[model samples]
Structures are given as structure tokens and as C-alpha cells.
Target: RGGCMGQCWYTAVDTQLYLIAPLLIVPLHYFKDLGKAWLYIMTLTSLIIPGAITNRSLSDHERLYVNETYSTPWCRANSWIVGIWTGYIIFKTGNQLKLKKWQVVVGWTTAFATGWMVMLGMYNVNEHEATTTYIIYEACHRAAWAACLGWVAIACHNGYGGIVNGFLSHPVWQPVSRLTYGLYLISLEVQDDLVKYSRKNLFYFTTLNM
Candidate 1:
């Protein structure tokens, strides 16, 4: 709620594990009956509950230190399907059905640009800003991202795009991507305060220091 990073992680939760974990597991084992564990994980992802038993004994309104978290498992399920499909399409296009060189360049660039547009479009906007529009835009955005990632993979497969792939494959992004989980864990707790404080004392911060 405080900073851009905090909000991004929340949205990422919805985009990634929320849909992803279930998609991955559902095909293998939970096809007939998705487990309670999946539901529980997605439920907590909304982060709306009062507090768990382990909560620091915080309370609100008429309830004890507990609150209700609400989410749509169906929506999450659909998103998971879409995410997987996007990846599938990219792979098929790049491998099974090859595109002409110029076409490859066009498709790759357009896909990449579209992905950035969606990602950046959602960055500053709070999740609660406009629920319906946000949801639709995000769905489109994520689909584009999947395609973008797939195209990059395709280019790598083609072998000549080594420079681009090499950059991405570099040790630099590796650590950040690998540490994403830890970053998510630590950043969320602190971002709320940091963002709030920064906004309150805007003059105190200079962009160069960031």
C-alpha cells in the first residue's frame, strides 16, 4: 500500500503463484479435485484477513484479531490457463512453425513492446483504483508478457540472438530473479512504511539517491 514495489509484489502474487502454482500442480495431480492447500494459499494471497492465530493479537471492528479474506478461485483458475496457453503459443510459433526473419523481428519487437506497456501501465496504479478495468487490462498484459518471454526463448533457440540472450543470461539479472522470493518477503513489510514516509516528506528525497 505504501510503495511501487509493495504493490507490484501483490499484483505479482496474483499473476504468478496464485495462478501459476495451481496451473502447474493441477495438471499433474489435482485434476480431479484441487486440494485445500491450493485454496488456502490463494486465499491468504489476498492478504485481507484480520490476523491469523499467530497474528500479533490485533483486532478490528466487532471481531477479534481476525478478519475475512475474499477472492475468486475461478478467476485465478482461468488466469492460470491463459498464462500456460500464452507460453505454449510462443513455443509453438518459435519452434514448430518458424516465422520469416523480418516477421520474427516484428513479432518479437511488438510482443516485447506490448509486454512493457502492460507492465508499466499497471505499475503506479493501486490495485483498488479501478477493479474491473484493472482486471481486464492485467489479463491482456500478462498474456502479452508470456508471449514476450516465449519470443525471447525462441530467439535464443535461433542461436544468433546470443547478444540479447547473453545480456539476459548474465549473472546480474540472475541474482535478482533468484532472490525474487526473498525480496518479496522483505520488501512488502517495509514498503508500506517507506512509501508513506517518502510521500509525506517528498522534499527530503532526491532521485539520484534512489
Candidate 2:
């Protein structure tokens, strides 16, 4: 049953990594500037090298298990690393980096473009069957997404986002943000159950319609 829920193992691994990574990096974090550089290098290398090796070495089933357990973390660690680095920048600069009008346009454009590419890839995954190209995309997409988001954050924090900033900063979103952690914990199970139930009823629904 646990294995039937596709993301259950990944979620469990994610939980452990979230708790343990910071503790392991505490010494590195103490160095401020150097720490940020080290984290950037480490997370980038973690994303690239391991994925390249795994893609070349592992059999399909073995790769799937490795992705669920090992590869997912290496890819996702970028998000945490980027978040910490961006937070530090915001703190030190008081989030005051002013951009040119063109820069703001470029930032938002890149964000939308990369984000939509990720969505498109996921939508087409069955067609691609996690080919080497798709595997590379999966490994690198999150980091690209994170980079785009960092731009969005910079634009929003510095008041360059215009309508985008207004939408993101809306008071209504605050409550939703507050619920994010709880929702994050349970969402995989909810999604799995919903998917299973929907698939089970599909034939019945189709027959009724017919």
C-alpha cells in the first residue's frame, strides 16, 4: 500500500532531508559569504554530477528507485540552497536591488517561460518515457525554476513587479501561505487517493454517459 502511493517514499525522504541538511550544514552556514558560495557550488554539483552518473549507470527499475530515494533529494536540495541564499541577500541588502525597466521585463519573462516549460514537460512525460533528454530536463528543471523564482522575488521585493507584485502581496494569500506547511505534508496522500478513486470510477462514469 505504501508503495502504491507513488510519492510516499519520496515524501518520506524529503522530510528526513529537510530536518537533517541544515544540521549538517551548520558549520558551513557560520561563514556567511563563503558559506553561500560553498552552498551554491555544492548544490549545483549535486544536481549535475550525480544525475549524469545515475542516468548512465542505472537500469530503468533501479533508476526509478534511485530517483525516489537519492536523485530527488539531490535535485530538490537546490530549492533549499537557493532559498537560504536569497534570504541572506534580502537581509543584507534589505531587499533593495533596483533594476532597470528592461531588466524587470526580462526577469518576469524568463520566469514565465521556464515555469511553463516545466509544466509542458510534465504533461508530455508519457510520450518521452524519461528518455535521457527527459531525464536531463527533470534533473535540471527545478534549478531553472528556482533561478526564475529568485528573479521574481528580487523584482517583487524591490517594487519592480507592478501588477505581479500586487497579486503576490495580496492579504488573502497570507492565510494560504500559513497553511502551506500542513498542506505540503498531506497533499501527496490526498492526491494519490484522488487519482486512484478517479481512475476506478472512470469506466462507470463512461458507461453511465453512454
Candidate 3:
């Protein structure tokens, strides 16, 4: 549901992130259509995500986010915990040699499999699709990602040939990952507004959909 050109229109469906925010960001960034005002916001956001996600209290300050957090306890129990753990490990083992090629491959594969399995489990059983669930799920995903990236780096340390390593090490990954914050901000707001609008407007629904 949206006010298209100030006329209220109602719909039962709302699109997801890839379809929604990219629909907005791509044009803004690529076509150079955004006015000078948005440039400052985008630049500020790129700096905010890394640190915002790094610490837990940044989210704890807000009541809405506190309620929305999928991650429980928010401090001792979090993906940020994994981040702390990983950082400790890297610092402790900084001198150690990277994993052997076979070991790296197996580690990466295991990481990917575990990540997908965990996400599926969460999706099926977790009823709270709110902020809390999202935080926990994202934390899990981020931990898995850290493992995968760590292993991939080890795999590519000697030489890079495998498809996974090639893609991971691709020059585009850096830029794209940076934009994830912008994408996150843009998409979350858009989807929230879209869902709220739809839930309110589309009241006279048949049995076809909610």
C-alpha cells in the first residue's frame, strides 16, 4: 500500500529487500539523480553500520529496537559475542599459519552448511519475526559469515582458483558490502511502512490472503 502521487492505493503484498531498496538505492547511486541533500545522509550511514553493529548498547538505547531485537539478553547472549570471540581468536593466533588448502575448503563448506541450517531452523520455529528475532538471526548469520570469510582467506592465502575464493576475493565485494548498511536502512524503513500501510488499508480481503 502506498500513496502513489498522493492518491491512496491499497495492495495485499509487500516486496522484500532486494526488490524494494535496491529499487531505490540503485537509481539514487547509479543514475546520479539524488539531490545534494541525500549525499550527506548516505555518506554518514556508510560510517555508522560497522560500529553500530559492533557494540550492543547502540541498539539498547531505543525502546522500539530493544523490543524488536530477536537476540535475547542483548549483552552476554549475542552474535556480538561471537564477534568478540573471533577477534580474540585472531589476536591470539595472529602468528599461526593459515589453514591448509583442504582444511580451508572443508571449513568453508561446513560454515556455509551450518549457516543455512541454522537460518532455516530459526525461520521455521521462531515466531517473533520482530527486531529481536532479526538481531539474533543476523548475529548468527554474521558469525557464520565471519567463519566463512576467515576460512576463505585461508584457502586463498596460498593461491586462488576455486569458485568460492574467486567470488569472495572479487574486487566488487568490498564496495557491495559497504552498501549493505545503506541498503539495510533504506529497505527496513520502506518495508515497515509498506507492511503497516497494507495491514491497515487492505481490510476487506477475501480468503485468498491476509
**lDDT tens digits, residue span 1-210, model 2:** 236655466576578677867743674558866766777687777577545755665466464645552546665676666666666667667866877788878778888998898777667656756667656775677677777788778777888878988999999999899998778668888988899888743345566688
What's the CA error at residue 193 for candidate 1, in Å? 3.3
Point out the higher-scoring one by TM-score: 1 or 3: 1
- Residue-pair clash count for candidate 2: 0
Instruction: Name the top TM-score candidate.
Output: 2
Quality of model 2 by C-alpha lDDT: 0.69
Over 4 Å off in model 2, which ranges? 1-33, 61-72, 122-130, 200-210
Q: Which numbered prediction scores highest in lDDT against the true structure?
A: 2
The residue pairs found clashing in candidate 1 are 50-67
- Reference-based TM-score of each model: 0.48, 0.72, 0.42
- Give per-residue CA lDDT, model 1, range 1-210, as digits (tens): 234453353464466555456545454344423443554454333222222221332234235211221123332333344444445454446545555778877877786687778768767556555544444453344345655765676667665354887887788897689888777677766877798877753456678867
| Per-candidate RMSD, Å | 11.1, 4.7, 15.3
Q: What is the C-alpha local distance difference test score of each model?
A: 0.51, 0.69, 0.48
lDDT of 3 by residue, 105-178 (tens): 67767877876766574665336535555444444554455555554454455453378758777898898998
Better of 1 and 2 by TM-score: 2
